[model samples]
Target: MERFIEEELAIAKSVDLCAVAEYLGYTIRRVGKYYTIKEMDSIRIYSRSHWFRWSRQYEKGENGGSQIDFMRVFAGMEVKEAVFWLLDFAGYRRIEEPENRIVLKNQVVDKQEEKKTFILPVAAGSNTYLISYLNQERAISKVIIDYFIKKELIYEARGYHNIVFKGNDKAGITRFASMRGVFDKEGRAFKCDVAGNDKRYGFNDVNENSDVLVVFESAIDLMSYMDICADYESNKLALGMLSDAPLETFLTEHPQIVTLRFCLDNDEPGRKAAVELMEKYYQNGYEVEDCPPPVGYKDYNEWLKATKLLQRVPEEKAVMKSAHGMAK
Candidate 1:
């Protein structure tokens, strides 16, 4: 039994000792006590109580010189019986040598080491950066994020982090993707990661108490328009379909919302979605209106920049195509 315990302890250094202990139906700390990290280290006794000593008389070497003499004393088992029990715990078997009289031992080995965990790559310009097809992280700062926040087009969560400008230390930033929207003095949706959803998009504001709803395909466009009409209040509510799915869900849920202002992106997909929505919902007792871009700009962000409706980006810099869903 002592021999088997030593073998198991050796295997545990390479594997998970805690797991092995659990498999053997013993606590990890209790099992670990049998093995010393360094050879020649004396084993530490678990406890020394007068009552326990009086109950059983344990001579150290009686149990084959094992440190578990205390266990034998407590269990009221003879040295041979205790050894048998320990061997049974380790699933070992004893065999007699052939001709003369030698003893042999056998034990089963059934364990495999666990694998390591996977790690993701860092973004561009990072020393450890690698490429990924999906740049969802970049979508946060695209004109859409600001538009959503400014226009109140979506239900901004209370205590949500604010976007930070380069020069301002006061502005708090929660969105890790805001760097993608970094543009020149112009408000154009750049090639950064602009294609994605916001939490508040496609949500209704109950406290506003309005029957008329304003819907937009993307968050930025909705927000740009919100700044354009800050004075208008009441009866009008904003709806941002984070994507095509939410747009469909919104239309299905609010079939009775009569007025839907479609302020989608000026691109082909956006225009197609708007036309499809108009055909489907407008005929079903709904009033649909298209808010086309003012021209020379691909989206509301560009128009807003052109009109100086929001903060000006650098004029010399280029808007990231990846941020604006224009990247391949």
Candidate 2:
């Protein structure tokens, strides 16, 4: 575990709570002098860096504090993880002591460590769980799933039955892999990167002949976009994370690409990232377009699910539903 000094903790706490909420993918709306999260309206943000969960206040007696507390309560991160996340969000990376040297009580100590190798998890005998999770639960089309499976970019891992999304370099060597559990735990699906996975090569479907690139926040979002826009032809890349390392690598590999479409989530973090990236890339001589999901939808996957749900409803019922929503 990493330890932080008092100054480090203070710096982390100094980060804006509203911005931290946005970084965690929550949408905030201004209500008079205070701000409330759209997804969880019970929480109110005020005084710049302070917040209060009014719903919890009745029971917990005013449950709120600095950004660290917000992370602990809302983001469900431990104190250390919350602090580390906040520091990272503020563009701070902690520099630890040299790997070979350690000082304890003014005494010098030395240690040796072995480097770890990158390896994909063992494959499962069948993709029954993977297929069902993607098609039935996620609403991703069978054709799109099959296309990626055929390319060996996706597979069901053994032991845990996780859906592993692999990333390959220009030479077709697997360099990165992110795993997603088929089952939901406490309403959240398990997700993590494989050990030693490289962020420079994110899961992607690059079309050498296309000059346009569509970027998404995750593999699921990328597939959702593909399912929605079946006829469109363009290169697609999943950033895996919000940073642009993968995008930069892809651009370096595919200089023919001139246009970029950022299809990140419509939430605060996604929107802010899209705007920042658009400006950065636009200044770098690339035509950039902000292609966020429609209003009220969080991400492409959610939008796809809503679209599928609407399609299943009877035509008259759909019209009536739209009319009712409009009336509200």
Candidate 3:
């Protein structure tokens, strides 16, 4: 049991809360060491941390850990599922749930905590950096990117070149903010959420009248897939979870969700999470499919990169041929 505990704790420390938020579909904003959401005040996910783990503190109470505990407290997920989801979220390909998983009691919530308000970061002058990063480096379509900016779903934050992903409630109040640095260099990234946040709000494209729900781990992944499949469908909702915490809630709110598709990363944890969700929802009579990247690809972004490269190559060869024919 000690070994199990140690191992599980290690996995918890590895979960990325921001990624979890994006995967779970929560809106988070960061201002220094605090991350707050719109829906849940008193609770703030601590912003200062490495990629290996995250910490949370409640103004009215105390109950915190990394992504694992976030899922447990926020989503009421069991320890096994929480750990499994976190491990997968981290792309910890080797971490697997044991056949006979240990069941732990649920986290105790503090009822007396006062609600708090979430604030968005000061807005930037322009999305120059945001546009460049998503378009040139990430290769996303400008039209699609413009749509998000136009919809106010994302923007460039003031003071830094970080990108802001906003989460708004039904009343249209901005509740969650997740900011990510555009300066990552193949290592750890700079990101955080605003303090005093609520988990109820998310960066979603859910259609009340739609019957299909497409889930992804991050907004970039969701948008990348959107770039690949350019056709639009209003009856289909595309929701990206910063973590999987919001999966259950989104489904609950949308009883019309009959077809569930997971477009998570192609790693082991991503696949594991997809399978688990499929089995759980399949039993509930939902049509489910695991849609990872094409074989040998790590993610939609990678696939997009390769596809774009191939396309350019053909065009370049065509140009070369035309020049040669003209010379003849």
The candidate maximizing lDDT is 2
Per-candidate clashes come to 21, 0, 37
Regions more than 4 Å wrong, model 2: 1-114, 315-328
Off by over 4 Å in 1: 1-208, 231-243, 251-256, 309-328
In model 1, what lDDT does residue 286 have?
74
- Give the local distance difference test score of model 1: 0.38
Candidate 2 residue-wise lDDT, 1-328, digit = tens: 2478765676676665666677578997999998989998988887557788877786562388877788888778888888888666543446677766855697655765654589998998789879988998899999999999998999998755779999988778899999887644112345678877888989988688899999999999999998998934799999998999999999998899999999999988999999999999999999999999899999999999999888878887978999999999
Candidate numbers sorted by TM-score from highest down: 2, 3, 1
Clashing pairs for predicted structure model 2, backbone only:
none
Number of clashing residue pairs, candidate 3: 37
TM-score of 2: 0.63
Candidate lDDT values, in order = 0.38, 0.83, 0.67
Which residue ranges in model 3 land beyond 4 Å of their true spot? Answer: 1-116, 234-243, 324-328
lDDT of 1 by residue, 177-251 (tens): 221122111122222121232322233322134446666544345445654565234222223333444444444
Q: Comparing candidate 2 with candidate 3, which one achieves the higher lDDT?
A: 2
